[model samples]
Target chain A: MAAIMAKPSLKTLKCTQCGGAIELRGGHNVRSIVCQYCGSCLDSKDQFKLIHKFLNQKRPFMPLKIGASGKLKGILFTVIGVLQYEEREAGEFFRWLEYLLFSPTHGYVWLCFEDGHWVMMHEVKDLPETQVEIVSPRKTRFKARDKTFKVFENAQAHISYVEGELTWQAKQNEKILYLDAVCPPYMYSIEMRGSEQEFFWGEYISVKDINAGFRIESFEPATVFSCQPFVVSPLFEALSKGALIASVITLVMYFLISSSGTPVMQHHFGNQLFADGETSKEFKVDKPGSLYGITVHTPNLKNAWSFFDVRVVDRDETNKLFTMPTTLSFYDGYEDGEYWSEGDTEVVSYFRIPEAGEFKLAVDGEGGTGEEPAEGFSLSGVNVSIREGVRLGHYTLTWFVLCLLAAAPYFVKYMLFEQSRWHDDEEDDD
Target chain B: MAVMLTCPSCGNQITQITRSPQVLVCPACNTTSFLQNGRLEDVGKSAILTDIPSIFQINRTYRHKDWKFSPVGRVRYDYGDGWWDEWYVRGENGKESWVSVDEGEIAIEVLVQEGLNVPPFEKLSVGGVLMINRQRMTIIEKNRCTMIGAQGELPFKVIPNETYDYVDLLGPKRSSFTIEYQAGGVECYKGVWVDPFEIAEA
Candidate 1:
């Protein structure tokens, strides 16, 4: 048997919709062919049928260079074929390419050299549409406690670098046109260059633009950067201690009022009565009338008499010697003997005490039959004593004192060491 | 060997006929005839006209091995000295195919074989003469029928009488040609156009 080697199929078809060509198969199979240029597809068999025929004719080749220009988002751009260049070239071309690929939408044109490298850029106009306005550079000085430093004018707007050690003479053309880098730490410096000074500084300068145009006028250190220790004064400390003492006294008064109990006073008095027989009954005091008075006094006296008064009556009534009724009389004064008279009803009242206190009444009667003179009656004298009110305890006072003591140190330190308006002025000086 | 023939009705002269035992029909009276012993004899009225002429010819001899034209496609080949040869062929499927030739003979033969089918004639090159009738087309080279076209418009057709000023054949000389239906008249003629790549059997 002979082996039959099959040849690869060479007959191909072209897409009707998008002008792209493809290879065909047995019995004109209906397969989709997509145009590479426009991405249109021929899905149906009728659509894939070719209207024009092309013979597989062989021809020669030609070399040509072509370019295309188009607009994207209103920005005109030109795309060139591949470019070729040497490796050593300083990649300005590559930078231009990167700018084109990543830059914001702007009109750009690209060039392709024969070496297959590419360069793309926006066309450079005579002047930039936007420009920077620079004010004239000036010089200034800063002081921190004892340390002095010079800050060039316009330094706040930009960064400043020192051309040399702190010097009296100012450098020329202090303005900084561009900032390249910034160096840190205590000596804070900036690296900058200007178009006018480009030749003087060359490519870049370590320190060139600081303290350039204006006079230093005066040099001083900045207090914020100072590291000096602070000390407190004695007068302020004493004033703070006095404030704490006043606070302690006020706290003690508050505690005393809150802790003590209410105040009260007591007094007692007694009296006895007797009846006479025969013509007249006479009463006499066994103990002399000492005039015992119980008086209760406070800041307001009207409330003291509510508990002071007492009412008394005789219990025994005996023989006809009581034919004469006993009369009671009251005396207002001891010297003048002004008396209160009872008419038919035989009760007498003499005086009232302003405060609650015990008082005694003396009584005497005329005897009608004159027997043995009436037996004498007597009343006992009252007793009274003054007592102190209950007091609040001492621990409350001690706690108040302790609270004041606890706050004293912080108060003293704040008064003496904290910075004030006057201290800010002092810090501003070198 | 070749045969010379005279038209039976018009007595017009014809020569260099092939020994392939083929028939010819005269353009004057439409006489059906065959070549015998270096002369032409008329067959009876039952004989009918059969061969036609081709206006365009393939100038190369060999055909490409891989060349195939389905429909509308174009191919190009590079010749030496920066010249290009191109071919476009229209197919029955209403598709076109193009092939290009370059400096090498093997590449040219491959392109030719892919583009054209086998000619039912013989030994035809550039500068050959063609005879046409209602039925068949024939190619005469050196006054002999070196190639023949089958009757009835062959499976594929060419635009007739369309001449090309091939740079290789004439060395920068220009030419004009036209294509027409045999019964009607010439359709269109193009003057001084570059020669097209040759077609051959695959």
Candidate 2:
């Protein structure tokens, strides 16, 4: 329960310990006020009597001073108190500053600043759904309100310093166990001290918003925080979507337009007798600048090799339009007590027809066996075939590569960002 | 209808502003009195209430969002750590309600007398859950509050310096439920938390 004084009046009282003037801003609800001058903790209910003297009280780095009023989300809150906490584990120390904000309407809220990050937290009464199951020794999972949370840290924290007014008597060096669970941009925390446990829900506040709310330009976070949500750029999102749409369109076009070309020429040559050359009958290329598919096959060549220097000649036989060179070979034997084979007996290639006109196939090549001919085995001949207006498979392969190239950078960046957020979980697991 | 009564101690005319108020403090002499069977009975001097800055005053109307009510009387209670005030207010519709102010938080509540199954105060603890009128509510605070003072006119009897145990439960959307265990009987109030900043003098 909270005490209401919609219009809070300042009560100035002299400190019993040091006689320094102390200002109380929390109305009757303030139980303790620390003298900023002499570091004396006084009981506000008992004539400001000295409860404890916090000696050597050095002020930590604070951006918001006491009695400073600022409006957050259209509600005005005054910075009434500050509590600095420290946690020590594995010979490492972590410190944070918590500013107690009081709104005449919203009761109490906390703004925590740690490592250049800020979170605004409000105490809640409803318990999370799953409190009995522990995901691991250091982590847990629960659902509260509407969000699912993954426990980020469970550690014991100690109060290192206190200033301004507090609702309860906050002692120096008090220790309490706190657990923090996060669902990006929001965090659920539980603090346990003896028989009392308090729950607080928090939201990550960006530096820009904090600066605007408090009217101070402070800092930028250099590391990922527990509740910092990953924001995707609109440009990147549009680019990724565009790439996907392009891929689908390319696939549909490939399936709709792809076809094997009409046969134009076919030729066969005798074994070891085509050293001069061979020519095919005349054929007409109907479409100008269309694609042509050429295939060379050595049907009777076993454990032997063949090479072909092919060219497309005009009907007048004066000028050659294209030159395509290819080799076909087949070999097999037992090596190291294992059978092995290399090279292919047939090969295919593609070329663009220069113009729509009459043409003829000119082929010249050589054939021979690598070793002495096996018993009753001999090389026979070579077969050559050509077709015009063909669509090759490499067209789809090229489009696929282009699509992947467009989206890979943003994908890698997103993955790295997610990894950085959970980087500390690996160490905790270990 | 308004009934006029005379203060026993001050000999001053006291106008009973509302029909349901049982207790009235004389503005002239600060004498606390209660009406029984249409006659004023003296209950001695009213407890001294210290002057503090507050949002509400007796006989003043305040508006919160769309609600319009005038605070007719007040009862102050002292608990552990701090004190709070329960202002008995009458809305424009002639329905009575309570505006509880504690540590800058305010709750506008109405007395609930039917279909409530409240357990004993000793069985309740902070952070415990309770089902009231089929709605799940969480008990946020349990404390014994002592009646310290009274002012103006109140609907219920005010026993000066009498202490009673009470538990406050919170429900969804800032709903508040309070169960007060008094010596006479158990009383319950159901309401919603109102933002103090939204309250304005009407």
lDDT of candidate 2 over A52-112, digit per residue (tens): 8777777998988998887776667889899899999889999999998886556678889
For model 1, residues A144-174, the per-residue Cα lDDT tens digits are: 2123323221221221111110111112213
For candidate 2, the TM-score is: 0.65
Best by TM-score: 2
Candidate with top lDDT is: 2
Where is model 2 more than 4 Å wrong at Cα? A1-8, A131-140, A231-411, A426-430, B1-114, B120-139, B144-165, B170-177, B182-185, B189-202
- Clash number by candidate, in order: 85, 8
TM-score of each: 0.14, 0.65
RMSD of each: 41.5, 8.9
Q: Which CAPRI category fits model 2?
A: incorrect
Pairs in clash, predicted candidate 2:
A2-B102, A2-B103, A3-B102, A3-B103, A3-B104, A4-B102, A4-B103, A4-B104
- lDDT of model 2 at position B74: 90
lDDT of 1 by residue, B1-202 (tens): 5445677766855543222434444534544455555455665322221211111222212233334332111122222222222333343343333333222111111122222222232334445433322212222111111111111111122222222222111111122222222233223222222211223334
- iRMSD (Å) of candidate 1? 24.9
